[model samples]
Target: MEPVSPDRVSDAPDDRFDQSVEALIFASDVPLRDEDVARAIGEVTGADTTLEDIVAAVERLNAAYRATGRAFRVEQWGGGYRLATIPEQAGVVRALFEQEAEKRLSRSLLETLAVIAYKQPVTKPEIEHVRGVGADYALRQLMERGFVDVVGRADAIGRPLLYGTTDRFLDQFGLGDLSDLPTPREVEEILADPRFSRERAQLLAEWAADNQPPPPPADSSEPVGTRLRVVVSSDSPPTPSEADDADG
Candidate 1:
């Protein structure tokens, strides 16, 4: 058997490489890493395809798409390459999905998801504490929807399960990574919107209610009549004799 030569590997036509890479990218539901693309091409073509080759092929494919004004392009996101609609087409794309968007997660689910996304590797108790409500149902719903996942256990007592946003979450929201999440100002703007203000108010109210200290326990030992009299504050200033009697 003859050993494959480097020259023979380089002889593979660039267009063929580009086409192979394009096919893989188009077929993949998730992002394909450069190395993964190269490996797939090598397996199919029986050639040593390097990462550099895959990168060059992807560049050429994107260049062609730009020249032809394609509605979509392959982009590197979350450390992998995936096909996505170009930014210019976002308006129409969003309009097309408007009906489906209406059926999306409820405000409560979104609030729970926001807590998990921003404070990842967080536990359910921490999530509940932040939202001031039980998160069992929300967390289960998120997990079922393939957005949030149990990444690991926290170090605190019970080593409670720690949850984080999944890659699917990024894809669903058109985010490249966690860094692409809205900034503080953007979040404020979203909260300020009339549609979301009510939900925001509810969250704040819940948090406030949860953090408020419980009322002081009733003075069981004190006489009820005396307690009632002492609890009432009079407009008239207490006389010296009255103050002395109270102190006594």
Candidate 2:
């Protein structure tokens, strides 16, 4: 959802409810779900707080912020509420994060993360099959980053462990939930948009088209490792030659 604009909203009456909600969200170390907000408010006032009340209260708070030209707004993300600086504040806010840019996740890890997020409860082999590359290193990195988790085991043969996205993943991407993720149809629509650049559009299109795993030399049931050549990208596990050099 887009942040509220200062020019778009009229002045709202200042009220205690908006104040309490604002204070709670602003003070939170993490996003607070509506129920969490309601419970916290109810505990303070000794009154029943409903989910609808909490939602409306936040909307009113944002309206007040818009009318007052506040640089930030209370945003709903990861199925919860958190304060975020408006786009107009991006210049200075971005400067604060620029130095840490090199620490960002690599493309391979992002691709693996995307697969897991879209097809959660999927197994390592399944992820490997989709990407035509090893996912062990990427999975480990994602786990360490708190974005992925071992949800359970696949009910298939050998009961391979199943992986799924964590709430941290939703928060990192500013998604309210899995349902907010863009579908394949949406991606195609984006690629087809008239405003899209032709060159980059073709690159993405080619990548998507060529991402299919190679056919098995024998049967499709052959092991994924045998069916595809291993790649050593910036994020993939090191090859034997590279590992040997590192040891030396």
Candidate 3:
């Protein structure tokens, strides 16, 4: 004879409630919307469950997991809630599999990304306008790396696709938002590093001297290392060597 079992009407479903919910949240890749949770609950119980109850359940799970110091927790992402590790634990996670973080983005990619970051939602043509060269390869590279995405179609004559940065782009660049990026002056300074070779620094220094006001007399000295921005013509492309040196 089969062993006696717990009552079917009450015990089993109650015991499995949290486990089923956990599984549902865990298995989902994108965040699960609140309505999706309600539908799942209704399917399991054969009765509609309110969105409020699902939220309450999720809140309880979040609280319990917080107290437990679990490796992962439920997070809101992509407009839905899903389980994810705290970002601070990234090093631990990566080390568990013995991986080194990848190299920084190439100079061309960084410049291209920077242009898009400032001008989006912009089309490739617009990016080339500011960059003064075709941006096709850089755009393809950014898309492949998940740094940029097709955000919309441009309103121009041909309706080219518009591009914008992904959330991953922000994470990779350590920026809180697009507004956190350095200004043109800062970018110029960064590109003027001595490691770029003496000729490059001289060019930047000459450019700076030509554009900036003369130093004030000793009593009213200007701030050190501040440089004025020289506007470049949108029609003329930067020379490939200057771009390569700047990239360096």
On lDDT, the leading prediction is 2
Clashing pairs in 1: none
Model 3 spans > 4 angstroms off: 1-19, 50-52, 102-121, 129-134, 164-248
Q: Give the Cα lDDT of each candidate.
A: 0.79, 0.81, 0.73
TM-score, one value per model:
0.58, 0.69, 0.51
Task: For each of the candidates, give the backbone clash count.
Answer: 0, 0, 0
- What order do candidates take by TM-score, descending? 2, 1, 3
Candidate 1 lDDT over 1-248, as tens digits, reads 12223343444687677778999999988878777887887788789988777777777777778767888888877557899998888778889878555456799999999999999989998999998999999999999999999999988988899999998888777777899888656877776788785665576566655555455468755443432243232435677898899779
Candidate 2 lDDT (Cα, whole model)?
0.81
Q: How far is each candidate from the true structure, as Cα RMSD in Å? A: 13.5, 14.2, 14.3
Give the local distance difference test score of model 1.
0.79
- 1-248: candidate 2 lDDT, tens digit per residue: 23444453234533577778889999997988988888888898887778777777788778768878999888888789999999888778878878644357799999999999999989999999999999999999999999999999988989999999999889888898899897766878877877676565566556544664676678466665422343323244567897899789
Work out candidate 3's RMSD over C-alphas: 14.3
Residue 142 C-alpha lDDT in model 1: 97
Candidate 2, residue 121: lDDT: 86
